[model samples]
Target: MISHHLLLCATPAKALCCPDPAAGQASWDSLKRLVREWGLEDPARPEGIVLRTKADCLRICAEGPVLLIWPEGIVYGGVSAERVERILREHVIGGTPIDAWIVKRLPFRPAAA
Candidate 1:
C-alpha cells in the first residue's frame, strides 16, 4: 500500500515559480535518491511505501521548488537539495513536521467513494 505521495513542483511550465530550473531539478534528484536509498519503496515493510512525483507546477507560484506531502497535506517552501534529507527523515518518517520550512497546509479531504 502507498503511505504518502510526495509532489514536488520542480519544473514549472512558466518561470514564475522557480527562477532557476536547475535548482528545482537538483531538489527532485535528491528526493528520488533518498526515497530509494531509504527503502521506502520496499513492499515488505509495514509502514507502506512512499511514492514521489515530479510535478511541473503545483500552482503555488512563490515557493519555488515546493514539496507537498499529501494526506497530511504539508506544503514546504524553499526546498533545496539539502533540505530533502531532513524532510524525509523528520516529517515523512519521524511523523513530525518542521514548522519553520512549512509554507502552507491543505489537508486532503476525499469525497465519498
Candidate 2:
C-alpha cells in the first residue's frame, strides 16, 4: 500500500518558480536519494511505502523548488537539498509535519463515488 505521495516541482519548463534550475535539480536529487535510503518505498512497512514524483510545476510559482505531500496535501516551499532530510524524518517518517517550512496546506477532498 502506498501511504504518501511526494510531488516536487524541481524543473519547471518556464523557470518562473526557481531562478536557478540547478538548485531545483539538487532538491529533486536529494529527495530521490533520501526516499530510497530511508526505506520509505518498502510496501511491507506498517505505514506503507511512499511514492515520489518530480513535478515540473506545481502552480505555486513564487516559491521555487516547492514540495507537495499528497493525502495530507501539505505544500512546503523553498525546498532545498538541505531541507529534504528534516522534512522526511519529521513529517514522512515521524508522522508529524513541520509547520515552519509549510507554505500552504490543501487537504485532500476526494469526491464521493
Candidate 3:
C-alpha cells in the first residue's frame, strides 16, 4: 500500500471549471501536471508523499480549486496555476501553510429584523 503524505481532494468540476464533468479533461490534466512537478512521486521521499482524490463535493464550491493537506487539516481555496508554485515551494516544500491565500471562514451572520 502506498502511504501518501499529501492528499489533494479534487472534484470533477475543478477540472472542467464548471459544476459537472462536461467541462472536458483540461482541468484534470492541469492538476496532474502540478502533481508531477511537485515531486510527489520521488522515491527518496516518504513512502506516500502525495495523493489525489476525486471528491463529489467538498462543500466549498464557491471556492473552486480547493486542496486539503492532511494531518494538518489545512484547506486551501481559490488556487490557480500561478499560485501552485508558491503552494509547492512554500507550503508543501517548506512545511507551512500559506496564510496569504488561505480561505478564512467567517462567522455566520444572523438576519436583522
Candidate 4:
C-alpha cells in the first residue's frame, strides 16, 4: 500500500500560479517522472510507496505550483521541473524537509483516538 502522498496543483485561480500555468503542469510531469525514476510509483515497489496526485487548485496559488506532501503536510511553492529531483531526494527519500522553497507548512496531524 502507498504510504506517502503528494498532491500538486493542476489548476490555477485568477492566474495566481507563479509565472504561468505551464509551471504547475511542469511540476506535475516532473513529479511523476521523478517518482517513477526513483521507483516510488512502481506497483511491485517496496513498502512506503509514494503516490502523486493532481488537484484543481490549492488556494495558496500565488507563489505556486504548490505541492503538498501528505500525512506530513509539507507544503512547497515554486516547485518547477528544475526543483523536483532535489525535493524528492532531500525531502522525500532522505526524510529531511527543504525550508528555502517552502511557502507554508503544517505539522503532520494524526487521527484522533
Candidate 5:
C-alpha cells in the first residue's frame, strides 16, 4: 500500500471569499489531473499523494484561498485557478514550494472595524 503525500487547503469561508468557486474548482480539478499523470497515486508505491481541503482559518483573510503544504510547513496565498495548475505541476510535483505566492507569517492585530 502507498502512503498519501499531498494536501490541498480549502476552507468554506475561504472558498466563499473567492471571486468564483467555479474557478477554484477548476484549479483543484487540474491539480487532480496532474497527480494522476505524475503517478503520485500508484498503490504499489511506498508513498502516494493526498489532497486535503481544510476548513480552518489560516488568519490571512486578506489573502483568501490559501494552500499549505505540510511537513515542509509552506503556505501559499492568493491562489487562483490558473496559477494552481503550475503550482501543482511544477512546485508540488517538482518537490519545491512556490515562494512567489507564499504568505509570510506576520504579527496578528485586531482590526479597528
Candidate 6:
C-alpha cells in the first residue's frame, strides 16, 4: 500500500471546482518533482511511499487549487508551488502536516494494497 495518496485538482480554466488552475498546475509539478527526488516514485518503492495524480476536480470549488493527502485525509486549499514544497518536506516526508494550510481533516485509514 502507498504511504500517501495525493489528489490534486488541475481543472481547466473557468471550472467551478478550481478557481486557479495555474496554481494547481504548479502544485502538481512540484509534487511530481519532490516525490521523485525523495525516491518515492520508484516502481519498487516501499509500501509507505507516496502516489500522486492530477484530478479533474476535487469538489472543493470555493478555494480552488485543492490538494488532498491520504490515508490521513488532510485536505489543503489554495495550494501553490511554495506551499507544495513545505507540504512535501513537513507533511509527506516529515509526518507532520501543516495544520494552518489544512482546510479539512478526515479519519486516517490505511491504504489497501
> In candidate 4, which residue pairs clash?
none
On TM-score, who's better, 1 or 4? Answer: 1
Model 2 lDDT at residue 111: 85
- TM values, all candidates: 0.93, 0.93, 0.61, 0.85, 0.63, 0.82
- Please identify model 1 stretches exceeding 4 Å from their true place: 110-113
Give residue 7's lDDT in candidate 2 (0 to 100).
96
Per-candidate RMSD, Å: 1.7, 1.5, 8.2, 1.9, 7.7, 3.3
Q: How many clashes does each candidate structure show, in the order listed?
A: 0, 0, 3, 0, 4, 0
Instruction: Give the candidates in order of TM-score, highest first.
Output: 1, 2, 4, 6, 5, 3
Residue by residue across 1-113, what tens digits does model 4's lDDT show? 87679988855555666557788778788899899988887778766789888876777766787888876888898888888889889888888889999888877667799
Model 1: which residue pairs collide? none
Predicted candidate 2 versus true structure: per-residue lDDT over 1-113, tens digit per residue: 88889999898898887888999999999999999888889777889999999988888887878999988999999889989889999998888999999999897677899
Per-residue alpha-carbon lDDT of candidate 1 for residues 7-108, written as tens digits (9 for 90 to 100): 999978887778889989999999999999999988976889999999878878787789999779988999999999999999899999899999998976
Q: Over 4 Å off in model 3, which ranges? A: 1-28, 46-48, 104-113
Ten residues in sequence with the least summed lDDT for candidate 5: 2-11
Better of 2 and 3 by lDDT: 2
| Model 5 global lDDT (CA atoms, 0 to 1) | 0.58
lDDT scores for all predictions?
0.90, 0.90, 0.56, 0.81, 0.58, 0.80
- Candidate 5 TM-score, true structure as reference: 0.63
The regions of model 4 sitting more than 4 angstroms off are 108-110
